[model samples]
Target: RIAWLKNYAGIDYMVPDPQNPHARVINPVLLNITQGPPNVQPRPRQNLNILDHGQWRHLVVGVTALSHANKPSVTPVKVLSDKITKIYSDIRQFAKIA
Candidate 1:
């Protein structure tokens, strides 16, 4: 996973922090994108050609977190799809209100 991250995700170097031995610190640039409300639709799985590293990471992390949050019953793919639908519905409602 580390090699894949370094090669494909453009994460050059990840080293253990001097102060916190257990914590690893990656290149600052990889942490450029801030956490916030969802701003873009996750790239469709059928379209695996999308080269946006940030979006890919976002989708993977979001899906993983959601799956973990509702574990032991809900499937990961189902959770991700349901979340995507809900996000779109919320966006539409917000737009209507605005």
Candidate 2:
């Protein structure tokens, strides 16, 4: 996934929504939640050169596929904020360059 991000950074990929489709760049928070190894804590998005720029305009997160049959839990606003914060912070140092 990181490799994919590296190749497509700053490009707005389509997010397939039923009613209204949207576009978003990949981010560490969404990557951790959807693609990280099972049961392992996801790492912070640091040293990732591609993630240093572009503001997130939408909330939709793109995933390769769903692994479980059960529905995902609803995320609280605070936790979601933290995740986004961490992701942005990890890439904050490179915001100017990206």
Per-prediction TM-score: 0.31, 0.27
Please write out the lDDT profile of model 2 over residues 1-98, one tens digit for every residue: 54444332321233344455573344323444455575565675434445433425232132211211112353444444544665567667867652
- Cα lDDT tens digits, model 1, 13-87, are 565677899998874544554555655546644553234456556776654553344243767676566656655
Q: What overall lDDT, based on C-alpha atoms, would model 1 receive against the true structure?
A: 0.53
- Highest-lDDT candidate: 1
Clashes by residue pair, model 2: none
Minimum summed lDDT over a 10-residue window in model 1 is located at 63-72
Report the backbone clash tally of model 2. Answer: 0
- The candidate that wins on TM-score is 1
Off by over 4 Å in 1: 1-64, 93-98
lDDT of each candidate versus the true structure: 0.53, 0.40
Off by over 4 Å in 2: 1-55, 59-75
C-alpha lDDT of candidate 2 relative to the true structure: 0.40
